[model samples]
Target: MDHREIIQILNEKKKICLLIDASKYATILTNDSFKFEECLRIISKLTSDLRIINKILNKKSPKDKITSLTNILLQLYGCMLALTNGDVSQENSNDKNNIESNSIKFVKGKYGKPLLESSMPIKFSMTTDKLFSSMFLTKGLEDTEVGIDVANVINYCGSNCIDLFRDIFTEQEFNYLSTSPNATTELQKARLFTKYWSFKESYSKYTGEGLNCAFQKVNFGELTIEDDTTIKTYDLHDDIGLVLNFYSKWIDSNRVLTVCYKCSNDHKDNYIVHKRIDLRDVLNYLNGADIFD
Candidate 1:
């Protein structure tokens, strides 16, 4: 979809999962299809903050490339919020009149979770594998939480990943993998192990605990995989009064994606909408398209 069309959906739904192909971005940079100077020019029009612009421009490494893409998307998302009269930083409350002030800034939460510098309820989390990356964004209450993780099966399937990461899974989980019919083959075991690992990572990310959380004790309930399907549903264990939902699926033959969040029971059906996006559209938006119209 076009940039404005995507913004319209985000305006209506207030949450979206953007699936991005890292290869496309890599092509753009390596082919010199989009000059670095031109990128800076486009970004400079969005914000006069030279420090932020310079930092983004210096993202040359593989990890830095993903961060750079995230920075661009956040800036565009901030613009959408401004057009839709959504929450924005107090200093930029007048951004409607000065579009350049729409650039986004981030600060660390108590546990080092990246949060918007503004007190706005805008929340986002990102995950990247070798080929693709995904970002989950939502505008909700302060208590809202969302997390995502993606992994390539081939990366783990080559080795005995289950044994290497055995400490992360509970005894029950390990037994399930050992006895389940689905784990009869090495490849099957790898996919199942990667799926469980991604789920645990998603939950840890959701809790803002990251690697500090005790994953083995965080029971994921019963994950019965009778067949190879894209999407699977299961009842997630809950907190005191909070209900958390989880969604996972195979993005393709080799890649798996997982998302965890807090929302109403019924909200799982539509709480977070997924949209596969082209980096070109995002670049166009960053290049100064009128997302409001």
Candidate 2:
């Protein structure tokens, strides 16, 4: 669907007041024409917050390094846009930069979880799979860390990967998957596999370690509250805690959207979670378009 259509759906749902256009990530990464100069131009238009970009650009000693540097900038910018209530525009300034700067610095914690600078009022984390990206935005209601992940279920089903990751599953999870009288064995395996992957990615992102930590070290199982859901937690080094929530919805008969979120108890009831594909409606509103229009 086009951007406008996506925005309409989001507006109708009213689950969130912010929208981040991540649709450009895949395009920018895969396209050869996406040069550093073009990327800089896009960044300039995307945020009036120049201080961060200046810091990034100034650190590169070689001028030629700007092209590769843009990738890092885009990832950070994408995360910021996804988490905050803001818009991409040429006329804005870095007034909000201080607020972001205080809360968004990245550092490594025990087991190498990427830690946010402790001073920020909120924390956010995310993970992206082939075609989809998921982000969790949390205000530090009480010093909570949060992360999210999304993936396509169809891809995991085709590779016999579920069995390969069986060691990561708790005994209950293994028995449930193996013994369930589900319709087709392949379909059942795919569902279980997607849950594990989504939950694992979410947990890893929560700790800021990403894929650096081994998945087998974490234990996961299906929760009784939801028939098709799975939850997992990690006991990483330091006092860092990890929790994952997994769910899947079919995009088509052959494709599914698997999403997972990671968070600590401090984040309870302090944020709203939403998923949307369109951004133009929010863009229009941010630009002062009449809602009635």
Candidate 3:
């Protein structure tokens, strides 16, 4: 489907749905081609709300590249989809004016954390695999951040990579993985490896450091979240107030999906998590239900 068609589908849902599927492209360059095309299609569909973005794109502004511009468009569409009901066409003169007046500029923060202008209250986060990208947006949620990451565990480490990462594991985590009967096989090692990688990526996204933070210093196995329970304190940078929560589903015996969210409030004490088995299933769930539903 074209980008506008996708936006219409999303707008009809009245919620944000960040879809990531990497199987379509071969590498980052090719992935950019596909993603940029999707962005153009989305902007075309958003003709009513494309003033600032279109101006930048049309003028070929030096401050941003075509790829960054495309990312901004995707983020804006996601933010709009999340904040408004299906009636986004009913323009808010204030937001429209903000768009036109340069009151809300899309700019990159340290380590490339894309930020909507400080004046704008919207918050967003995104992550990618070799071929797919995922993004999330929320309104008026304090210290709100959303991170989505996909990794091929086998690709990061050879057969022994899990062992390498395991060396850094906390005692509690090490005892579980090392002694668990499942770790005897290569496939199990790969699964554990991906889980750790996803956790670190999610944590990095939480800190807004991306890859600039030291992964070795942060151990994923030490952190755990049980159903209906949340842990508030963990060893992380002082500047970051992060609540890490994740959902994982096995796509196959070999592939998996893990999503992480960062929030300022204590969601763990009262939050309910919903999960799906695959990308298409996630799309269907998010599209069909209200956030509270």
Q: Residue 145's C-alpha lDDT in candidate 1?
A: 76
lDDT per residue as tens, model 1, 1-293: 54444445555565677777756456545556345456656666655557656666576674465556555554454444434443333543333334445555556677877666555567767777654668777664346877888866777744456667778888888778667776777777778777887788987888788999788866665464322233334334453344566677777887777787776433335335677876566655555453212
Q: Tell me the TM-score of each prediction against the true structure.
A: 0.76, 0.55, 0.57
What tens digits encode model 3's per-residue C-alpha lDDT throughout 81-139? 34333343435311433343333345667677667665434566765443344565444
Worst 10 residues of 1 by lDDT: 225-234
The positional error of residue 288 in candidate 1, measured at the CA in angstroms, is 2.2
Prediction RMSDs, each to the true structure? 5.5, 8.7, 9.1
Candidates 1 and 3 compared by TM-score, better number: 1
Candidate 3 is scored at a TM of 0.57
Clashes per model (N, Cα, C within 3 A):
0, 3, 0
lDDT of 3: 0.47
Ranking by TM-score: 1, 3, 2
The Cα local distance difference test for each model comes to 0.63, 0.44, 0.47
Q: Among these predicted structures, which one has the highest TM-score?
A: 1
Error of 3 at 247 (Å): 3.4
Worst 10 residues of 2 by lDDT: 9-18
